[model samples]
Target: MEQTIQKRLPVGGDSWVTVDVYGEPDTPGLVVVPGVMSDAHTWRHVAGSVDAWPSVVVVNRRGRAPSGALTNSYSLRTEIEDLGVVLDEFDSARTLFGWSYGGLITLLAANERPIPQVIAYEPVMRPFGRHALPDLKVAEGTADWDRCVEIVNRQISGFSAAHVDGLRADPHSWATLRRLSGPLYAELSALNAEPPPDLMAQQAEQADLIIGQRNRGTAPYGTSFDHVRQHVVHAEVHELPGQGHLAHIQAPAELGHLLNNLAAI
Candidate 1:
């Protein structure tokens, strides 16, 4: 097994963030912000495959395990500040990679501070149709992880019944997804509650938006891709053949290759 370097930084008096450091530390590398239900532990495989940078700094954002809990005051700003902390401290993290919700944060963070290079994969930039958060919240409140997982997979993720069943059949995957559901409720609720962020002020010099070919034309994700192409200057969209939203997990090497190419520019 490859080694992972871990660092925990206190964000505020109450909140904390942990980062998994992979690759060489001799130089600044790409900083990765993960999705709604993932942190360093879950992102390990994908982070490992990305060798285009000197290091891979994956942020374990709030609401996820190994990081602080979602405080009553947690909001989008909290997520940005946590990411900003990593960016401010890590001078090597001049480029950023964001997945799903993390992609949204990457764009938002670029707005606050100009990033030299930014890449986002299927960011839920605009709140899509109903996530049934009320139901998901109730399930979470009662510790009904299974129900919570089902709702998120079917509703938030747009997974088919068969897909959900397959996930449930895999004990290991299901267990991780269930654990992640605890934080999913709060994060999705925050995404749904906030009005669409102002993309006009985003300041990335180079930006790339990636969408899975299988995920194209999907309601929420489709519009999100369009939104980025429409709003972000120099934003280019790339579709991965034979893939879906989970490409980072399903095809990390391929995704890493694509990112490396994007960075080569």
Candidate 2:
């Protein structure tokens, strides 16, 4: 399986963003956005499988692996700008796909652009009350990296072992889990410092919502989606039974098929 990988230098920085392009260059474009602390590599398996799409660009969001500068402040506006920089470089009309935090970025980006289509696999709209974190301990008062890692590890391990095993089996999914464990916790702490209620509402208005019925970790757990569904005129919901947060990994074939159908429409 051959893949074309490129280090794209998006304007506004020297930090060259990592981009993985699959299939032909001139084909209809699909941009894959990874969740927090994830890299372009997270979409490797799915990109390889979706050969029908003309082009798929997987992005390594700023401050993640294979990218530069791990900053302490993780602002939603800055993250959305980073994505805008990437979008400016591409010539083709594109469809945006986001998972978890990436979904938040995707929704924000759509607000600033004329995105013809958008697909999100359970975006973390927690600020809108769609997700809850009862046990989530926000790390503060310490900039210690090791402490951050320890806190994140403990939280991850607390989840069901069977669920973790299912994630580990998928290369694309587990790679993200391993790389993002620490940074995700740190970012979560930063986000907790200042909840983005206004931004969350803005994102919901912009996105064509796609809700996973069993995605209890994010959308299913909160009232954010309910608010989003009410406002977004083009919002469409799909319920996948026996699937959780990582539906793209757990049900890749089903997701891929659905995406293919979406592209056709």
Candidate 3:
């Protein structure tokens, strides 16, 4: 296994963001951006499996860091700005590999700033319809965080009851999900209030749209891909056979192989 190096880059204020780098220097860089409630650690297996072990940087987005305080607010624009900082900090010829919410962030960021290529895995872009951004809010400004997390897993991500139960039984996994609820809440609110971005207007010359075959039958995902197929220019679709939304976690080797193939192009 390759050694992973962690570095912190200042994102202004007193806040700093971390990136985990793997593989050799002076190689084409791959920036792995995780979905909501996720951090750099989630991509470790995938990064390690990349062919030839080209440089890979996995980012620890705000609020998902294992240590340090999170940013006070969340918004589409702010997230893009943070990504901009990461790009500058890494400073390499790069491709953006984004999963779910991170994919959505890449879509928007690529519009504002051009990147070499983007591979988006089931980006949570409500191109076809809105996600059920449930109002878990209370009068006193509290929320049923656990309930919201369950809703996201069940309704949005299409996890089964057994799957949810298994997650609950895993103390580390459950704790990470709970910790993500707040930022997830903020991100959902921002997405619901603002209109979805126009896919046709995206600046990237190449976009590899990846979807799990199992995900095609799931809610919003099926329709979301339909919209992407019709409109997104310079787009090519890749289906991960028998996988679902969590392909990166469930099949990291497969994901890594696919990424390595793209980088070889």
Measured against the true structure, the TM-scores of the candidates, in listed sequence, are 0.93, 0.74, 0.87
Off by over 4 Å in 3: 12-14, 67-73, 127-131, 138-144
Instruction: Give the per-residue lDDT of model 1 (tens digit) for 1-265.
Output: 1336888888864888988888765467889899876767767777777777778888888777788887888777788888888887787676988988888888888888988888999887656534487888789889999998888878866779998999999999999888887887778767766665556327888888898898787666766667655666668778888888888788887888888788887
Query: What TM-score quantifies how close candidate 2 is to the native fold?
Result: 0.74
Candidate 2 regions with alpha-carbon error over 4 angstroms: 11-14, 128-158, 161-178, 189-207, 216-224
Q: Give the Å shift of residue 135 in candidate 1.
A: 1.1
- List per-prediction Cα lDDT, in the order shown: 0.79, 0.59, 0.72
Which of the two candidates, 1 or 2, achieves a greater TM-score against the reference?
A: 1
| Top lDDT model | 1
Query: What is candidate 3's local distance difference test score?
Result: 0.72
TM-score, prediction 1: 0.93
- Report the lDDT tens digits of candidate 2 across residue range 1-265: 2377675655344454667777665566888888754567656776766654678888877666566654544466667777787777665736888876787678767766777677776665545321222333333234444333344434432445565566567886555555565455544544444444443324332344555666433433334556444544556666656665555655766666667766776
Who is ahead in lDDT, 1 or 2?
A: 1
lDDT (tens digit, per residue) of candidate 3 on 1-265: 3645788877744577788888765566888888776777877898889754368888788766653444565566667888889888776746888887788777777787777788888876653223445443431146566776687777666778998899899988898777777666666665565666555427776888889998784666766666655556778888888887777789999988888887777
TM-score order of candidates, best first?
1, 3, 2
The residue pairs found clashing in candidate 2 are 129-223, 130-222, 130-223, 130-224, 131-222
